[model samples]
Target: MNTIPEIATRLASLCNEFKFVEAYIELYADNAVSIDPNNKNEPITGLHNLIEYEKRFLSNVEIHDIKVSEAIFAGSYFSLVFSMNFTVIGQGSKMVEEICVYKVENGKIVSQQFFIG
Candidate 1:
């Protein structure tokens, strides 16, 4: 079972490499929940649903760069600052910065919530 720090490290590495789905599949629990403020502020429950949501988003954007900060941990939770530069298909380029917080239980990430900045 991976510790919080270990999971955080792997998540950051995978995200930096643009392996978002891979990270999710490897680190998240089956019934994981994802809350994205930009997505109507509704929680997307289940790993399958979360992955589908991510895929939809990815299909609509051309990611230019991604920067993930070192994780800050407190008990079973950890947070990271993610800055992404991307272009929406047929739209325009934009940069977004967000604080991503994750909750880990029994070696798997059970929930993630993002705060856009």
Candidate 2:
């Protein structure tokens, strides 16, 4: 069994902290999807767009009090809850929690989806 910690830590470090493009790209497949509740038009695809979209969001962003929960590792699928305090431009800071499910293969995420409320 592969440790979910490896993937989780990388994701947290890349997305929540450094916004490392290379690490971010390494996590997803060529055709990955991200569904965002805050944004109406989502499920964005492709690695380049994913990195660019993340860069666009994290350009002047701040996150705190991040917690991951409900992590279930079932072979090729991993699901977890990511909760954090986020501050974005134009939109004030708020504490939000989203459920993210990742489909993994060969230690890399092939597809990812987010369900937020």
Q: Backbone clashes per model, in order? A: 0, 0
Best by TM-score: 1
Where is model 1 more than 4 Å wrong at Cα?
none
lDDT of candidate 1 over 1-117, digit per residue (tens)? 499999999999999999999999999999999989978889999999999999999999999999999999999999999999999999999999999999999999999999999
- Candidate 2 structure quality by residue, lDDT tens digits, 87-117: 8767788888788888876666767777876
Model 1: worst 10 consecutive residues (lDDT sum): 33-42
Q: What lDDT score goes with residue 87 in model 1? A: 99
Error of 2 at 64 (Å): 3.2
- On the 0 to 100 scale, the lDDT of residue 34 in model 2 is 68
In model 2, residue pairs whose N, Cα or C atoms come closer than 3 Å (at least 3 residues apart or on different chains), thus clashing, are none
TM-score of each: 0.98, 0.75
Error of 1 at 16 (Å): 0.3
Which candidate has the top score in lDDT? 1
